[model samples]
Target: MSIEIFDGIFRYGAMTLLLLICVFLLRSHRSIWPGRLGASAALCTAAYLGCTVAEQDWVILLLLPACIANSVFVWMFGLSLLKERFRPGWPHWGLMVLILTTGLWRKFFADADQMIPVVLEWAHQFIIMGMALHLLWVAWSGRANDLIEARRRFRLYFIAFTPVTMIAIAVIDLWLTPDVAPYFLMALQSFSIWVFAMVILLQAVQLVPEVLFFPAVVLEKNLPNVVSAVDQIAARDLATLNAWIEARDGFFETGLTIRNLGDTIGIPEHRLRRLINSEIGFRNFNDFLNHHRIEEAQKRLLDPTLARLPILTIAMDLGYGSIGPFNRAFLERAGQTPSRFRLQMPPGSS
Candidate 1:
């Protein structure tokens, strides 16, 4: 088959599949961000396909807008990882405007300047790749903090999809020569989109009970055996878990260490560490203690009877040697200092 014929077939086929995925996203009741992004991506893909099939010089102008759409798709995924409802702020708008301006200048003003277009395209691809990688890192690192099952699953899907798509595109753009058949690149792009679409479909299927009764079963299949083994340990150590929970309030002891606590509780320090880290989902010993201390502090801070008590007094009472550590921990968890939190609380709150 001729390269042009293959490219046409692949592009059209990909566009059709992308359109269906866009429609499915739009129909879903879930967050609209993904749908909007998918739609924009689909539109850009269609435009690029049109340009390729038509063999028109004017189609080169479409590259800039397509790049912007792709960037927005990546930006939206990043925002989804950080917040439930993300409105594009000044930085995002400024970056998009700057990219669009540069692309326009290259297409219109850089007459016969092959170097400028090449440079701009290279810069654009690198920026997109960097942003996608950063978002994937954020998703991977923040997964433990995400308590909502659906949102966590969505983040996982994005984490899995973004790096592969970005790396593949980077390789194709950097290494592929003009002499190479366009269908090869088209096929690679289509396959990546197909995989992403499949991920979304699987996520949607999780919403339907008949299609898959237990979504976690599928997720567990993908996870390492270490996680399940840890879960088993967490389940089996019920006595230690209960003892730790009952004695968690003692965590406020000044200069308390895991070894000292383990000695007092008659559990091995290493086992206690595992129980706290694996069972309780805390990554650090300090964080585990901080969580309990901060909870108690919050109660006292908002207590109507204790409203007149000084913040430092409460901090010291919570086993914190000084107010500074307590204040920082409270602020980290509550997004405000103890005094501010007390002031904001409704009067007469118990």
Candidate 2:
């Protein structure tokens, strides 16, 4: 009959279900740490839920365990994603402003007589939503170059969980009024249970990433290798390397690309991308391809052997659909205009 009794039952049931599922997963899978982390986070959720049902005198004690769990969840989920993408800075600070302001408005003005507890509820929702939103943004920025699968998974979590958690918080906040039997809180709690269930199911179904189990590697600032890693992702392949070289040779072929070449070699696009980055060290995929195209163009221009050929003919031959991009690429690699370079070369010179 009492709210304390009701909340306690709800929290215990939720925690029990999550723990059982975690135990099942750990048993089914050989991997240990991810399961442990998931269990830890679930336990934290249980503790926080228990806090909701605790007497005012016992609230702080019950909440402490959950707080530790929440912090751990943030770190563990975000550890692999902590490059420039998720590092706390302008975007996070800006999002924090939204959360704090919402708390201030809900606590200070929404229901003044019920301010303290309402504010607490709002603050709880604020923190969860803020984290969810931040992680979503991180996933988005991470996906800018290509749709990496891990990023898609993180984005799904942010989108699916954050709103459910926010709704639950709001329900508990509104339940402060005596006329309400706190159906909102109950509904919200149910949704929270559902969200966790989905997360458990998803983890069970999805392929675990290598990074998820690997010992963490800390990257240092000012390491040249950092930039090199990025470049290798962009450039480092011989076929990719040769593609650029052949393009510069002024071989005119429409729709030439890594994909076409990859198909020819029976390699996938991702593998080709890796080859370009690791084997050749190019920061730009298209640029790497174009550089070789331009070089070939330049040679033909400078070569007395091919000096008599028209620039348009050469441009088309080299994969340039137009003279403009070809000339620009030529100047970038050769440090001068193609015509200028051609004219400067002696009659018998290469």
Candidate 3:
């Protein structure tokens, strides 16, 4: 049996599977933040695998963008999975450097045994593993804050699936040699991607978007319109929560946890979480708090009387531990930075 034929079968078969999954992800209105990233990742992964199996130089060159960007798309998709908005930081810049160096190494220093090639290969694996760990961290850290029942349950699986799968793939690529069957290696990588697409497929079901998305946060005024299945028990709980939180100033206290909020508000912590999610339309408790906080932040940013106060002071005053969360929340709500919002909008501008 020819190795070429073996590679041809598995590689082409995997590409077809990836393309089909890609089409499924993009069909209808499913192509949104995380799903869109997922589809792109699938396409990129297929392209990367295709280029690897291609014997021709032109094929490699033509598919190089998707090939190289596979990691980037996967990283971004992982960030989006938990439904919390992602803030780009040093890792993003580091990824760019890795991509640049990897491309340069492949183009100029084709020698496999060279110091630079070895270092580059190891660095690439490190980033892949690091990104997986990051995803694990995001899922674990955000689990308590997540509200959607499906998301809460999925956290455990995600924590296990993301890191192990990613690290395993990295290790397979890093440690395996040409002595091992190349088609087997390629088929294994392709299968890993297949599992990833299937996971995303599970999330993107139109009938149950809750599995994939952040709960829709709504203003108090719009709550009645947004809530669909409020029962008598939920209604009473909602009323109690509404009356209590408005009268209490402790909500403005920094580092307020949900347990503390529940205690002060005189509702069971679990019940409070449910009410906040089902009636008020928030998945994460912090997002609910930030909704109110950012509303006040918007007012403060536009308030001429408070103009003398600094943004940090305003943020700190609103119970944010620091400026970072404050800025992120402000941007999420106002669609711009506080400084920019203040600079651009007149005090009276709506």
Residues 1-350 of candidate 2 have per-residue lDDT tens digits of: 76556654555667676666566546654254555555555556566555555567557454754543453354344433322212244654454455445544553456667656566665656566556556556545544232234544555565566544644454454446323546545545745665665565455555544223233222222221232334543434443435544343332466566566566655677766555444444333455556556756766777777767888889888787888978877776677887887887785664
- Kindly list the per-residue Cα lDDT of model 3 for residues 250-305, writing each as its tens digit: 87899888888888878888888887887777878888888878877888878778
Report the number of clashing residue pairs per model: 0, 26, 0
Ten-residue stretch with the least lDDT total in model 3: 221-230
- Pitting candidate 2 against candidate 3, the one with the higher lDDT is 3
lDDT of 3 at 223: 58
Cα misplacement distance, residue 58 of candidate 3 (Å): 4.7
> What do the candidate models score in CA lDDT, each in turn?
0.61, 0.53, 0.74
- TM-scores, all candidates, are 0.56, 0.43, 0.81
- lDDT tens digits by residue: candidate 1, 80-164: 4344334556877677777677656765787565788778767766776777777778777666544344555666777777666
lDDT of 3 at 24: 74
Candidate 1 deviant stretches above 4 angstroms: 1-6, 30-32, 48-67, 78-89, 111-118, 143-161, 174-183, 205-350
What TM-score does prediction 2 earn? 0.43
Candidates arranged by TM-score, highest first: 3, 1, 2
